[model samples]
Target: MRIKVLALSLIGCCSAMAWAQQKEPTKPAETEVYEPVPPKVRVNEKGIPSDAIVLFDGSNLDAWMSGRDGDAAQWTLNADGSMTVKDKAGDIRTRQEFGSVQLHIEWKSPAEVQRKGQNRGNSGIFLQDRYEVQVLDNNNNDTYVNGQVGSIYKQAIPLAMASKPSGEWNTYDIIYHAPVFGKLGEVIQKGSLTVIHNGVLIQDHFELLGTTEYIGWPKNKPHGKGAIRLQDHRDNSRVSYRNIWVRELE
Candidate 1:
């Protein structure tokens, strides 16, 4: 019994010594990843990244087409490097389709302030032509919280009201993720959106339930890449847009 006890103690001591002598990580680089370096992207004077695809630079409507009949865009191109909605003409959309992307766009309401509420400067930027990020001149105008400026139109209300003055240019920086669909046309992963309005964080990674609908429940019909659509509102709201760009993501 004494011999067996001595043997057990030796084995325990040997195990403890082995564990104590094992080397631990000492430098940060020991676990740092150096491969797969990201490519360089130069930002221009206008803050546009080199890797981005400029949808509109205030020059022409080359990247856009009418959303109604796939005809030429009927919006009015302004002398000030902007495009104004031609009332009743139709909505316009990008010719190229995209799945997930980072989008930057600047918009402004008419300086005259013709109407109020949803009738005043009502427009929207639709991601994948399905989900809407509402645009409204909510400066002193009151409306439903879910349909206000920067809201994900009836689906997600913005965290804050981050609109600029009714006529001044307001910027929207949006990061969007496309939904993944299963083989049976069901949603595997829901989409998400992060929006920064006029330099303020309005939507913080909000998961989308489905399409932003106006008259019924949100729907999740399976679809692939879709174009970015700009609404006309068809109410003579006269919303103008400029400096639009996008960066496609994997």
Candidate 2:
């Protein structure tokens, strides 16, 4: 009788312990306590934040240089506070190097549509001078969806086509998180991009696989902060840009 009672008590104790070990529902971990408040930034009519680094204010290309030959950017500066890409001038890149940033830029394809498919307005916005966010004239035009405007080059495609007309200006607000490199020059963490094209979210924190190569497979060349380059394309697409600025993220 005593043995039976002890066995019953032990089983009850084990059941109680098991019930205590089970997880109970609770509130989520609070992260708001650890986050700090960001500073306020006053934006101008051009939509450039006060803390932003004005790359092109429709005035000059002083902040840019030739990406191919390291010479001064040979793109044409117009009177309307915009710069037109000069055909065969090679690519132009920012003289300053940046990592994670919020970049704002406006671009427009030639009013006179010249070619079709990839040959038309075939420019690109390169992050870290390697990863490309295509800047093609995808308005009423169709090509490979992966290489269209607002795409993460040949890697991630856009969520939707949010391009304006050929002559109308289109804006790109890009949030880029640069890749992290390990000690042996290997990629520790891949980069990511979130793009808003004309107030519409196109690329939503898209992960970058590797370098945006035109041909062959994508390559991962471990690099630090790099210049923001614009492709020349040599297609005479006459792509124009204006009111470019960047705000570094902490």
Highest TM-score: which candidate? Answer: 1
Model 1 lDDT tens row, 134-232: 999998899999999999999888999988787899999999999999999999999999999989999999999999999999999999999999999
Error of 2 at 187 (Å): 2.0
Q: lDDT tens string, model 2, 53-165?
A: 99998888999999888999999999999999999999999999999999999999998988889999989999889999999987778899889988988898899898888
Query: C-alpha displacement of 18 in model 1, angstroms?
Result: 24
The TM-score values for the models, in the order shown, are 0.89, 0.85
RMSD of each: 10.3, 10.3
Clashing pairs in 1: none
Q: Candidates' lDDT values, in order?
A: 0.92, 0.88
